[model samples]
Target: MKYNEFLPITLEEMKARGWERADFIVITGDAYIDHPSFGAAVISRTLESAGYKVGIISQPNWRNVGDFKKLGKPKYGFLITAGNIDSMVNHYTVSKRRREKDYYSPGGKMGLRPDRASIVYCNMVKQAYKGVPIIIGGIEASLRRFAHYDYWSDKVRRSILFDSEADLLVFGMGEHQILEIAESLKNGLDIQYMHHIAGTCYKSDTKENLYHFIELPSYETIATDKIAYARAFKIQYEEQDAVRGKVLVQPHGNSYIVQNPPAMPLSEVELDRIYSLPYARKVHPIYEKDGGVPAIEEVKHSIISSRGCFGSCSFCALTFHQGRVIQSRSHTSILEEAEKIVKSEDFKGYIHDVGGPTANFRNIACEKQKKEGTCKNKQCLYPHPCRNLNVDHGEYLDLLRKLRKIKGVKKVFVRSGLRYDYIISDPKDTFLKELCEHHISGQLKVAPEHISPKVLDLMGKPRREVYDKFVDKYYKINQSLGKEQYLVPYLMSSHPGSDLKAAVEMAEYLRDIRYYPEQVQDFYPTPGTLSTCMFYTGLDPRNMKPVYVPKDRDEKAMQRALLQFKNPKNYELVKKALILAGRKDLIGFGPKALIKPLGKERQNIREVKYSNKKPATKNRNSSKNTKKR
Candidate 1:
């Protein structure tokens, strides 16, 4: 049962296994940690289970071909990834400065991976292996499978398949796609014929015959015209569903990049089998001396109960990657994993988390989704909850109950965010009560993003009133249970449709609520999201309405400062912002004032207030008598 001794990482290890060549070579930008939480570990293990000899090349040097040749050459092909996060996102912060630490690297190191790792690694592999097929996946490849705006480059970039020159690109949850690709290669199918597979993108010549496919605006057109780019993005967004989606093609130079419909959501039985694979559940021993991989600690004891999301927030990439469908593991499968966690030496009777993308979601949005796929043009939990949305948390609550009852388990927390709007819409309040009583660890985090209706609509979030009702109900339930808990809202600044006036209004709302967040998220324009489209084109892709975006660094800083106005460091920025908005009335001393005046002005106000006050009692005895009375 202990099948996870880890796959071969060196020539000696491969020779020891009596293999001259591996069926697959997985090249990754992360240290080799054989935990299920890691994508490389799962894919390699899944292939091994399917009778393919797989090898790993983790954090290989891109300066030369020597590192790429360590695994020799795979017989089937090379699977390349930029680790768990997009290479650019991993390497930089929101401010576009290089990060000092990479959790995916050994010893929390930096610079182990190159920028745009999937493209770089694939090129390296191609140089070393000659004509052997190359396949790229993970966040970097998935989000870039089409023409998208690149924040780092400050312009639109072509599909990664074109840039990496890989034979095929796998996007989204790739387990099923990996299996199908392997089977086709095993049957001696040509890589060119593999274009029809779902969840894949490949390059084709113009002479190739095409049928029943939607042609997006040519890459050349989008690259030059912002409006054309937004229009292209809109077409891609509408056809992401598996059941109703169409084959989409976009021309690039002489060749066209064809993307098949998304892969079908894995059924419960399939998801259970995937999660039940032999994962070592920790960082591999090869990384021990270098202080081990830092990313393993967070997920070592947690369970990924489900995958995908239907609460399609505009800023989120889940729809583009995971698709707007929910697929979850069976309760028995989750409990089995929990039992394994309980037996671990490091587990001290606590399970860090027990959920996925959206914690409480256990099934698809509605019954129609099971047969028809998700609605192509409408969302389930955005704008407003759909009439047919089947909102029930009973099964999820039951699973949590079972987890808590397992032996040696003291507590289980739902650290993944709850979709507040979804919870508030359910007529039955049973799930809400159970969530408050059992799952919370004194504080629950939720994403309301912004309070402005304009911004909220742009975010594909429910109106502010929906979140308000949820908060009120949450406290009401907690009070009845005799527990004191708080809701920590995730707020964003400088998103599209958020102007200086809106930012000031947000600050005023924060003042009213008495909540000053320690951290605020600046709108990050990552690829393949509606918000990113607006950030790039200055027009909402869905409606083609013009939107205001705070692109200047100073303007963005002012917006962020208003969110944390109580911090002394943000004082000057907040003062300047108030003046800019022509709200000087908020600058002086008053019950509603956001900040105080400096030095002489403050002292003069104090003196005026003191002089206007009634005189103090002259006699100490009379004062004492009054106090006694």
Candidate 2:
């Protein structure tokens, strides 16, 4: 249970002199889970499986220096990654009116500042052990892989490599790249000489060498515009196109150099191999006895599934990272893990949600097609679902049924948002009904972003009517089963083409449904994302057409307030919106009410003052004559 137990060396009196020769460690700033499904966890496990020793430093209170010391001394090298966390981006509201609440950090106030945390962690590791190689991966380092504009800071940022002070920065998916780096170090190859690997970024030997870049996927191709980006990569709801390609590499002070296209996505067998690592449900005894990840009070467990998104919301980044393929583990693997959870002393009643992007769609399709070799198309956020892609509810239904049967399992739940369209699309309605009856604990969260067709088209979401039909059907099914559950629809505000009018219409739709959401997300422009470009450029990058974009703060606030009429202030806001939208007629006003006042009344005061002397004289004379009579 001591810090030095896992380390090959001791750092009792480290201030005097530093030691060399590490056992090669991969230290991550991500939370450690037994299952290596996530990027950071998987990479760490991958390195360990390849014969290199790895230790996870998950979700450390990075502000404290002692937290870093707890990992002990690294005998070889260190791999530093924040997993899927992005450092360069800050939470922002595109709404015209900014509130104090809007400034609060996302996931509540306690969330760590990602960029600051990464920098501090990297520095602390280096100070503790000199000459240790620190490599940065995950979204934090990937999208910020080059010099780019940061909307949050409103400034251009250098590559994360320079900012984090890590030796090498790997962009895109890190599976193959991280493994290569670890193997080379274990074989006694210099870390500096390993830059030739694709999907990695390192400082060049000379300045001239920086410009002579390797050809990878062009950011220009993807960055042409939002529509173009969406068209190229967006996933249609039913289509299964696994378009894996090379990492788009941009060296310092040079144009984008894309590496070889993505390797064949990890097959089911490879995926199963990675997920099946012997991960301790709780932290290792040594680290856990002291306060490590899954802290003293928190339960320690890892996520089990990855990939498969049926929602196909245009603004999401999951489809880009994990792809649209619905790949899941065998039911036996899930049950085996559940049993392990029950056996663990630290097992709390909570087995955090079991899902990838979309939880419900599991082992839903086969890889090969009947006639076609493999589907190459990628955008699933289309109007209609795909015919080739299978929609089978039987496998997932059986899996859910089995998971509930685990003896020690208090409550097995599905926390990930469900794709109602896909659920209804299933040939049998049994899965939907059963899911509503058992899985939900009163409230089931769904994302029906907007009710307006114009807005839905822009978002690539199902029609408003589709959501309405699902809502009615959901309630009916719940009633039939004698269960009480309400649908919580996730809505977005101020997306591209969501003008004040469209926002007003959406608000009206919400009011008609008699539902008020506690959370409403303002669209933020993440780099390399389609929506972000559309927001910044003001033109659809695909067609170069001017899109209706609302940039005013007050307008955004008005739109946001319209959806929540529960607030008394919003009543006034609705009136203002009606007037601003030039729908005063909708307020039952006539032409007279709408017209401006005439000039005679406006000029009367001045005219009366100027003509006062003559008028007063004539009146006084008439009054004097009347008094005398």
Candidate 3:
């Protein structure tokens, strides 16, 4: 079979391919790169493989209708996305400042796409082609498919299905939903009547068609009442599963947004076929003159061995989007992809990465999850590992071993975020041993996020002690393997439940380790995260208990500064943070001081340090040592 070189992007290309119109036109906020890593490419290709002619319109000019009308009109419908990353996230910094560069754009150019791109592009399509079906998905639409807190807007907004005025919203990985939607459209089914498809959301005037679906709080109620909003998020979080997941519905005035349950996780053979799909595997030649798309470089030589993550960090929307179960490509499929990478001119005898969201998770967390679904009440690795969690890493190790053995492949690195909790949960040391010896170049990236127990629990991360144990094991493995390596722990600040005291505690821990974080991640409350729910409502959705959120600009900055206290620029912020948290003792030039007392106060400053000590404010989570399982 002749494979697709690149889906037509222009009228000339369309004519050259002998196509008058495409079956589907994929509108993306990112520059067109026909690689599987880009969602638009995968969705478009998935349609193309099913005998549908799919076209790509990437980073179109939203101010006018010409770019939207470039493909004339799709024979079936339009598939729109805000690219791999959310548009708002792509546009703004955590401090709500406009970003100077967009990785998905050509030459890392800024402002190629508008803010709230999914909404903007959908409206543009409607204006360009009247009455054509527009289906929105990708991370932006998937996470905001329900009434969600929009940080950029600083308010709870209605689902994208309504906001975009699109006919359908495909949440999660849309390969399944896209295929079904394409086939239905080809069979002459109306987009409105195509509401029964799983992993898709549609707006309806009545709830009569939905069966066994839970009704969440109305948009009006959630927008006004924080408790109701928290409650709504709680229900949404618990019900996001493929197996045993029920349909969910939320109301907005006269209509209901009905979300069908997520599609079943792809099987091993099915996932393998998707990665093996004919992809151009490079930025389109159109983008080459503009220094190419910056996003493709990271993924060019990499192999996505799996999809879906069960790590379920509170700040992560993977739980609400990809769901908890793991779906991986087969070993044969991965090796085949690796062999192709080896043949490339720029290979350099190195396989850059071989993993998914969480590199180590290659299967379902437990036997029960395979049939009954992830427990709505329990987590696989938070609080503590479940008694039934399957912790074997044998299969993943073997896959790595085979990739290492592949000809012309010198190194196979696991660069994705590896769950440290999952690592220590295993009784065997072989995975860690092999990891240090064969996988990493030097430093492995892990996300402990914070060392404060209260913040860790609220972030749905494992306890501080879990990170400690993992660190010890990591170093020990490196020492035994006769390799010199380091650990780069990804930490966050200003998350809910992280008060000044917690931030100070984190700073002190970093001091103890003699490691200072060069870059601090200030929590940005994006849509559909449990932590974002808490950030917006000031209450943990799990229990409706108040959480002290660091929302003030000064407090957020101070928290971020405390993490990098050793930086000379953060001296004043760290000193102020110490005084506010009643940790004035940490301000002097003593052995444990976070910062030296300013100016002449350095003269035996211990005597005057207590003068500025203010009583520490109330900590809502200080007494709550354990996660609420």
Candidate 4:
């Protein structure tokens, strides 16, 4: 098969492929982009590689069953996903306001998919064809496999398995899980009875067959009680590993949502096959008239060198979705992809990226993780690097060196989130030096998140000292190389444990650094993150200690304003925050003052400066929850 041979989307195409009906129809909430970066595309292509006829139904109109029926019923079932991102996150902003652009949609248009898209599509599929097996996967379903707190609804909702009509929910990467389920179905086994598959959740009536599992608080209890919710989240977070992870059963009213132990990470050769599939590497040509997918621009030239993160930031859902074990592609596979990219007509000499979930995590954190999986209790890098952590970036460094040597590739950038602490732990400066010389252009972006110890601890990030160490080392390396590269540190605001005082402390750090961020990542409490769990429950799931959560709208805005306190528009909010924190001393005309003394003349001057300019357009497509961070 060639790149031009896209999978069957329309029935005529299915007939052209000489198939009476598809064995499985993938219904996604995104415009069909047949690229490996897309989760839907990968799953569909993997099925096709296994000799299964897979059809795609991308972003069918929820109001009309006819749009879904267009693909017709499948022989096996329908594999549904809400695209690459969670539906609610794609639809709304941190403030619960509707976002104007959907990066995953055609031409960055919004409303291409409905909110709670997986459930909505399942309902529509049922209306279109009853009694057909419905299997739900993707970020939306994976993260919501348990009874999670829905940020959009501001209520604890039943597990997506219970709410949706999906017979099975593939919670992690579905390559293995989907194949197993498809084989079982092909052998005439019923979907309901196939609950033994790893990395999947199925609803069960009785607990008779559920053995060696831990039962969580019922959905009703966690919905009302915060403590119970925290407790449940703690248990769920701990048992996400493939090895030594037991079966987890959570009661949802009368039924139970049983999640088996996570599936094992694929080996290098197996992972290579996933990217080796004949992906068309473009948005389906049908959408060309609407302008190509805005999301593709960021990643079209990028290569995924690795998957999953052991960095284990509390605000990230990688733990729940991808697990902590890092799975990477072989260097040979990546080089092959680079050659193909170089051959493209649009090749710009620069390869956009050569990394993944965490760019530096090309291998396991330690040799122990290979067989035992990630430590259930200890983090690989947090307050400090684990004594057992094998912090070597040599393999990743070599991969980059090879890519940069590619004939047509001018530069290879590592544009993904990298753990500075990991770089700090490495004894050698070779990788850091090479990175400065070849990888970056003008500046490198890193997430310091906050400067407060208390907040950093809650976020599972290294202490401020570690970031300081990195900053010194980064600049020193650049200086030695005669390069003047800068660091664009990513910061977040209003996370749990970020009281007004802590927010003020972060402001003081910004003043010292002399960096004013244009965009501030205010903690968006999406489901399946420890930080989100803390936001909803006001208790740390790890310790059950009370965490001060800034829930008030005014306080949240004040915290955000404090980050960019240098902005003239934030004067009022900054003044209010400083006063509330009893740091009224900061509200004066001293050198340390965040804002100038409030006066009618000064205010008028500021207002004129602000109002004279055109309104700054927000890149609604550039969401803070982006995987890049």
Candidate 5:
């Protein structure tokens, strides 16, 4: 029952004792992946580094009163977060015909769990320990920072802070915000006065005092639609409305405020201070005691070399939270952490993966010199081969090589999918070839998203030709090395411009390449994202151009099926697609066709006694004339 009881004991023992308070506890519905790469691991480690004793309750199956009691009382309070489990948005369709077994979970359905994980966790914490302050963070709490559209229910849901009954919701990256909260609480600071934090949402007792309290700029105009959202937020999409960007809105309270991003990227000293913490690479006692681990098998004891992304995909939230500028740890610091993983007993041959938003892109910047410069353009996530940023792979390549040489390290793999266009874009192919030969485990994953020029343009992806060139070169290198490694290109369905024709073309491309993807992700419009805004508003917010949007669930489902031509159920979809493509002949003849031809003997019709048939009148008359002659 004691905090230092090294030997893990039952929850009953902890409950029996009246020890119902601790320094701090994290209430999360996400699986603890023990590695530093995940949200729970990083945040917990950061808090621990700041001298707070933290305990994690990862992915509790049932978030009830009993669950809270299991995690022995915290000394401080509770940090409630959903970690990386998407508790905010519903990613699955309700129709049974549309739902497919997740490739990741085998039989599991994709969507928000019925019993809200974050909400239940918060309620359980409050019920178990009275007067204890609870702080919530992560995607579930962050994206729901304001009143936004909920796709699952097809309605605007209230701010998560009010709905979850938590003290505060930390939006965006919580590295500094969480530390500030803990320090404030320890110093006897009340939750009511903690509204000054930039990336957080909290409720106030006084409604009249809200406007003067925080001066968030009006980002609502841009946030109102996806194009504007992408243009303003996408890291690589540099054309931002200089005066209009970085505005914050309290949708629930009907208030507006603005806070600038961290003036400069986190310094190495700051990063070291944060990433250097004693991380216990093990499952939380509560989860092990309960006999469950959601992503246990996939958990690779991971370490991050960098933070943020330069290739700002329009749909991604990383640029919004971490910024487009890449921040990295010293090579020494990264190696030191890698050594710890090598030393851990729990570590297998796999290090899970080592990379950030874009794995190969490390230690890059758009500016020639580090200075305070404002971006005014709207569409920052688009236009292939980002003109603003300098792409570098040397430092990353060196790190990868060094990691592989580390003693006790069996295999240092790059599980994160590479940005293929970026990799091939490098003038020197040595880095890429080495990456393919050393990092890959017979398969390298890449995201081409779509093959159509228009779709790719809309998605802010590199041209299809760029992907094609990379594929050709990648395969040639593989052949030379006599390696059977393959490039697994990920594709998306039902984007803003992706019509039935585009979907069919993509399917045909997949068939031509014989890339039968086992998994196909249907586009889910997450709140606060540009894609979601586009989904809601038909026009592109950037240029005010008319865009084709598919709202029909059935059309979306068919588009998804087109990606997975190998699935037997998709045979009809392939047939229909062929007809739609004006290639009906392909339906019965092509190799991609579901049905094959029978031999000549089977094609011939046989006459049976019971069969109804008409006599051959023309043949009989001709025979009679011949006989007379």
Candidate 6:
């Protein structure tokens, strides 16, 4: 159909669509934006395409069951998500302060939805309609499918399946698994039987049929024991692949939560079809009065040409959420979308981003990855590029070249990350030359994370020398192309292995490069990532090796300050950190100093400058002269 034919949201809209009842009532924590970037929109639209009637309840009021019953009971079940991001992460800052604004809400308003949105919404639905299937999905449910450490709660939380009392949990990208669930329900299969579907998690009273699967430590064991928690996380991490992955079972109270192997990556044609579906590509017009959803502006002009990331950064949740297998759309598919975008009334000459999880990853890591899933233990680009890595950007480069030639498109920018180490490994320098010559607006953002080898090793990032090598190559290519582009390296502080000494080392490296990052991320330990496990358990889950975790609040702030030590506000914290790390030498006015020491003279001057009134030196001198007279 057309873009205006969005799925039914209100009873009147349902009547207009000639539907008396929806097959699924989808509740979300975010305002309804019918764009592909919104998970609820995509899942609903995909179901609609399959002749299943779907209605949306966006940002439902969760204090009562009123908003949950707005769409009425569905014929089959209810699908719930905590929007694009986990609700807790969206509502609270890493420091546990409630944020004042929400990008997913209309007019960017806060408190549009409650915390732990998925669980709250599910409970509301459960209270409203007993015996109806309640399915939880999206970032919140997916990451918490097993017992995971909740940063906000500061304790291990049980599987969301148990907390929400939902029948099933759909983890990862749910295109395939969702369709299967819908089909099974439509064919008269019970929700319990839907457990066999890939990319789904279900609770069972008994593990009678569970075969050839690894069992994680029970919830009681993990919640009370950090080592057991770390061990459980490693087993879950390894069994996330589609090919080699097996069912993973974890005990929760008296029952068990079982996660089926991940769904297979979509083929080019399948991915193309999913993107080409008639998406309204905008926030629902109903939200116009309160101002449109702010989140839409970021992706309205961008194209998700691919999915999944093989970069495998330890701190990233993509591996757990989307898997590591890179699945990309055909160049033809992307060009067609570009043509549509150019014809839009709002088409500015720019295509904001032309990539997905990792922009340059347009194909699987290696040819063998397609037949056998990504290696469970070994990383593709970390430590070093795998010997068998097929590093060819030919397809991606050609895609960019064609998009550039589009009539109304002025620029095709790779706003998403470009894995630099991957680029340097390529035999041809054509992608690098073109990237610097055309794609870059001025500065390209790359993630080096940290300069310390110890920290980088824990982060699953390339060595410090590897990033330096790439930086050198990037500038060289830019110089050859007569471009004055800069590299904005993304840095993170307070990661698990980052001690005070490591933080100081990072500060020294920044001083040498003469680069002061305007923004630095203090590593946030969200659920379902290797790094988060390390942060919580103080051990590398992969090897159960003890890792030094900087858990002290003051120390984390110090680490953050060290990254931006050039800032006057952070000078004191940097100095404190330098002294603690035994790098007191970094607190001077020398070339090697990270911060200027707050000596008595400097402190007095700073106090005077900060005060509204000037120092009393003039008054004292006048009084002294008067006394002399």
lDDT on C-alpha atoms for all candidate structures: 0.90, 0.59, 0.89, 0.91, 0.63, 0.89
**lDDT (Cα, tens digit) per residue for candidate 5, span 112-196:** 2323567778877778888778888777776665555566666556667777788877766678788888888889888766776
Model 3: ten consecutive residues of lowest lDDT: 617-626
Worst 10 residues of 2 by lDDT: 99-108
Tens digit per residue, CA lDDT, model 3, 451-532: 8889888988888888899999999889987889999999999999999999999999999999988988999888989999
Q: How well is each residue in 473-539 modelled by candidate 4, as lDDT tens digits? A: 9999999999999999999999999999999999998988898999999999988999999999999
The TM-scores of all predictions, comma-separated, are 0.95, 0.75, 0.95, 0.95, 0.80, 0.94
Candidate 4 residues lying further than 4 Å off, grouped into runs, are 1-4, 600-629
Count of backbone collisions within predicted model 6 = 0
Q: What count of clashes does model 2 give?
A: 29
lDDT of 1 by residue, 1-629 (tens): 22237788888888989999899999999998887788998899889989999999999999999999998988999999999999899999878999999999999999999999998998898889788989899889999999888999898888999999999999988999999999999999989789768999999996357788999998889988989998999999999989999999999988899999999989999889888988778777888789888898899989999999999999999999998889999999999999999998889999999999999888788999888988878889777889999898888989999999999999998888789988988888998898889888898999999999899899999887888899999999999999999999999999999988899989998999899999999999999899999999999989899999889999999999999999999999999999999988888779899999988877777657655655663343455544653
lDDT: worst 10-residue window of model 4:
617-626
Poorest lDDT segment (10 consecutive residues) of candidate 1? 617-626
Model 1, TM vs. native: 0.95
* Clashes by residue pair, model 3: none
Model 2 agreement with the true structure over 1-629: per-residue lDDT tens digits: 33332322223323222333234545554444443444665676676677665555655566655656654766656677664455433223342233332111222233443444556678877777677788777766666555444567644455566677788777655677777777777678887666566556675434343433333223344443344334432222112233433233443444332233332345566666766775443333434333444321222343455455545566775544444456677776767777777776777665656666787767544445322323444333357567646777787788778877777776666877677887777778898887887677898899888888877876778898778888889999999989888888888888888987887787667756777777788776665554555566565544466677766777777777767645665666766776798755433323222222225643564445445658667576766644653
Question: How well does candidate 4 match the true structure in TM-score terms?
Answer: 0.95
Candidate 2 residues lying further than 4 Å off, grouped into runs, are: 1-21, 27-41, 56-76, 88-132, 146-148, 155-167, 171-173, 192-258, 283-303, 308-311, 346-352, 364-378, 569-572, 584-629
Listed per model in order, the count of residue pairs whose N, CA or C atoms clash below 3 Å is 0, 29, 0, 0, 25, 0
